[model samples]
Structure formats: C-alpha cells, structure tokens
Target: MMNESHAGTARAALPLSWAKRGLVSLFDSALVGGRPQQRYFAALGMAEDEIFTGYDAVDNGYFAQQAETVRVDAAACRRTHQLPPRYFLSLGRFVPKKNLPALIHAYRLFLNANPQSETHLVMVGAGPEDFQLRAQCVKLGLQVHEKSHIPERAPASGKWEQQRGSKPGVHFYGFRQIKENPLFYALAEAFILPSLYEEWGLVVNEAMASGLPVIVSERAGCAEDLLEKGFPENATFTSISVRRAGLRSKIRRNGFVFDPHSPEELSRVLGLLSSVAELRIAMGRASRVIVEKFSCENFGRNAWLAAQAAIEKQRSPAPAPARGELMIPPA
Candidate 1:
C-alpha cells in the first residue's frame, strides 16, 4: 500500500531518477501477493537493487522473557480465560481481512467433527466486525449453549476438570493487553491465523516465540518462512532437502497452509491439531526454531544491504543494461 503512495499526486513533482530506490518490507513468501507487488514495483520503474526484501520480524527476547513470566501463573490464565487444557487460538483485529468469521465457522466444524474432543477456540481482539462475529457465534449455537457448572477446584491430578454438559465453542475475549498475550499463547495448544489476505502477521512470530504450533492461511507472509524450512533438529546431520521432503509430515511441519479461504480446510487443520499432542509439540518447536532466521536483526541487516546496493546503483552514473538483454545467457 505504501508503494501506491509513491505514484500519488503528493509525490508527482519528484523526479523519477531522484526517487532513487525505495525499500519495501515483505514477509516470508515469494508467492501469494509477492509476485504482484514485485510487478508493481517494477512497473513503477524500480530496478532489482532499488527494491529490497525487508522481512517482517519481532522481538524474540520480549516474547521469550514474557513466556517465562507468564508460565509462572499459566493455570490462572486458563481459568480466567475459561480455556480448556487444549484449545486453538486466533488473535487479530476483528476486521474482515482477518477472517474471524471463517475461524468461527471452522470452530463449529471442528466441534461437529470431534464432539467429544474437549478442545475449545479462543479468539482475542476487537474490531469493526465485532458485532457480526458475536452474532455468528450466537447463530451457530456457540454463545448460548447449555452449560453444567464446572467446579472451581482442581482435581488430584492438578488439571481443571472439563465442564460436564457444556458444548465446546468459541471463547470471545475482546481486545486484551499485549503483555497478557504471551500467557494466552502459552496456554493454547496451537495458534491459528486464517486471514483471507495478510501480507505479514507479527502475531505468528509472537506465537512461534511462545512455542505454540501455528496454522496460517497460504496468503500469510510468514507461512512459508516459518513452515517450509524451519530449524532442523540436527543441522549437522539433516540436509535441507530432507527437511523440505517432510513438510507435510506431522513430525516436520510447524503448521499447514490452506487455500482460497475455506472453512473446511481450516476446520480439518484444527481437528488435526486438536487430535495429537505430539504433533502440536513438534510443530510448536519448529515454529519457534524457524523464527530465529527472521529476527529483527536479520531484517535490519537485509534493509541495510538493500540501501547500500541502491545508493551504489544511484551513484554509479552508468546506464543500466536492457532488461531483455540482461536475461539472455552468455555464450
């Protein structure tokens, strides 16, 4: 969207050459919205060096430290949030783009598929679409379901007992303090971001940092970066090719990417996460491990390199080679 402004009337007076190069930060995928954005920049007369990939990143230290801080009182959070031992979590603004409706629908689907699975859905965040989401929840029978009171006390095992008669449903906690988010991630069995079209999602990074497995849409920028080639358990022994080979395997993936915004796909993925504890642990580890490669430090370094390349390109005062000519293989 920032690129669109460069072509705006506000910048009409600036010479094209004087524009030099601009940096656009992109998240982890080369597909989805990536290709179109690149074409836009190229059409705007940006050369390869002029536009550099600055990936989306977050403070790993902050999440890591917060995770420890929150873990101290995790059970309290679970009770306060009315969360089960295992639940799928989605956090984002209540906007259409975030696709909260689809998530709710998928949650319904999950419950229908696994009527006995006590797993729940927790959505945190408030937005313009708030009323509609609540309405949808009500219509789906999630909001007004029958409930048998769960006892306030914990069992001998130390885990909270499930509500005997209440149906599993979405727990809508409107916007929460950012500081409390780590606790939410820590409590969740897995994190889900089913955005219809999100260029980059920082919450995915945060969830990964908190060591929760994630399920994001194919269009999410972080999906591939966090999912495709996450940190190898043994880099010394396992080749990247081997890792890629097992991307869809439950043992290897941090999450699964779904297509074209379907509730069924999201539902199926959620059901998978709900069914297996081992899968959740492995994927959560993978997400956290992969995120290290996309740290804020890495973003800064990549941006600096791009700027230097652009500055040098601008200063060279030489004619750029023709596009068609440059693509030809040399004899």
Candidate 2:
C-alpha cells in the first residue's frame, strides 16, 4: 500500500491490472502523487471499501521529541545571533516537481515589494536539478551562497552570510546535514513548500510541529486533511481547483490559493506575509496546535491497527463452498 518512489513507475504502468487484482493499495506520502493514483485505482474498479482509511500519519511520541528539540534549537539560535522575526525555510529535493523555480520567482517578487523587510529564505536538499534551480534563482535576482565544506567534506561552523552585491534578502545554504536541518527550521519564521506535486508531505507536519506557519500547495494530500483541522492558517495554495466553483469557494476562504505557474501571485502572498509579523506568529502558533493530533507515535499505532484489522478480515473462513456439487473433487 505504500507507493514508494522506486515502485511508483511500475505501479503507474499497471494501474488497471493492479486495481483489478485488489491486493495493492496506494498510500501516497507525497501529496502530488496520491490524488492521481486514487483516481486511477477508482477507475479500475477498486472501491473505497478496498482502500485504506485516512491519509495523515499520526505519531504523538515523535511529536513530543520533535517539539522538545525545536524549543532547544530555537533558544540556541536566538542566543547565538539576532535572527529575523520571520523567515521562510524549505526541505525537499531540488527538482522541477518540487517547484524551486516558482518559489525563487515568488521570493524575488516578495523582496522587491518590501525592500526593507528582514525576511530570509533557506533551502535544503540536493538533487540533479540543483544547479538549474540555483541558476534560475540567480537569474531572478535572488542571491545564492554555497555552504563550503559540507559534512561530507569537513566539519561546518553552520555560519552563513549574505553574498556581496546581491539582493538584500535572499540566501541559499547548499547540502546541509540532516541533523542540522531542525536547527534551520527552528530559526525560521515559517515553512514554505510550493511543490507542484506531493504525495503526503511529512515535512509540512514537521514544520507545524516546529511551530512554524506552513505555505504549501493544494496538490499535497496533507493539505486537504490539515486544512480540515484548521492548522497553519497561513498555508497558502499554489494549484488549480480540482473541485467545481462551489467547493473551491468554500475552501478558498480557508487558505490562499494561487496558480502554481504564476510567480506574481506567489510573490504577493509572501510580501503580505513579510509585511505582517504578528500574522506569521499567530499562524505559526495555530499550526502547532493543529498538528497535535498528528504525532508519529499515533501514526505508528494506527498503521499497526490497520494491518491487524486487514489480517483478521482475511483469516475469517469463507462461507461454505456455495452449493458446489463437486466440492471434494480429486481430494
């Protein structure tokens, strides 16, 4: 049921057959991939009865651990340097689908609109698309800085500065360690994941737990459920409305939805966020409250329970071989 990245291609190719077989259930962690797979499975005669219930992974214990870490890191960051009141951070692959280009464009707009704002954008993660994304950001007038002596090379001081003659507000910290990532999140004012597609987007949950407001795409499955719970009021949208106008109108009031292709809209939202410090703080606090129900321990427990239920269902004996005349043939 877990549609891991490695198996996605094969599963995509046999959508119909997989649905008919009914053994496979697609659990989309990346929000972008889940919706399409759900539709495909439905088309192949797999009813809601055959699929798993609920989408968000709940884990209370992990949340507690993460919360403690976030508090410590946030305090340490405040003591070390005078950090901005608010900033944006993202953690994902530097790929096209992750939508770095649009993010860069939107950030550029945000900076231009508020030249005096102290907001910063921090991006982490490496992929084949890193160079292209970096190049695009530079072209859009956002400054890029490579973190010299990465963990693979040597011990890093975790210190970074603005590049010379670059725009006043943009920064890029390339290839940071996983352990150091939480520190980045702790120092940020908000988390922005403007991905074109995602299956479940656990990073959003992590951001929420870190007490950071999240601005994610509607294409993410987590958004659908998270929005319902009313967490992270600042989680903006960047996708077309799949629902008709009626439903879209109802959801639009809950979050800011923009066309993923339009950097202007994205910039406008960021600019608005940057201008209002209280807004970010309120949204961040709200996000933390909303994600309390989605902890890692809860997720693990629920997954185990679901598996047990499925097993028990299978163990029950089938009804007597339906009026068959030759039930014991060749026995």
Q: Best candidate, TM-score-wise?
A: 1
Candidate 2 regions exceeding 4 Å error are: 3-50, 53-85, 148-162, 165-167, 229-258, 315-331
Q: Residue 155, candidate 1: how far off, in angstroms? A: 25
lDDT of 1 at 221: 58
- What's model 2's lDDT at 127? 86
Q: How does each model score on lDDT?
A: 0.64, 0.57
Clashes of 2: 22
lDDT for residue 121 in candidate 2, whole number 0-100: 76
User: What TM-score against the true fold does each predicted structure earn?
Assistant: 0.72, 0.69
What RMSD does each model have against the real structure? 9.7, 7.9
lDDT of 1 by residue, 237-330 (tens): 3333333433343223576777536788677777766766666777777777777876788777766766566557556655644565323233
Tens digit of lDDT per residue, candidate 2, span 1-331? 5431212223454444544344433321111123444454555444444344334554533544665676666655643433334568878887777888888878888788788876777777878876677677667766655543343454243333334443344455566665566666677776777777666678777777766667777666566545443323454532232132222322322234455677776676676656556656767677666676665555555456556656665677334334632232331
lDDT of candidate 1 at residue 66, scale 0 to 100? 85
Badly placed stretches (over 4 Å) of model 1 are 1-45, 49-51, 144-166, 229-252, 318-331
* Model 1: residue 141 alpha-carbon error in angstroms: 1.5
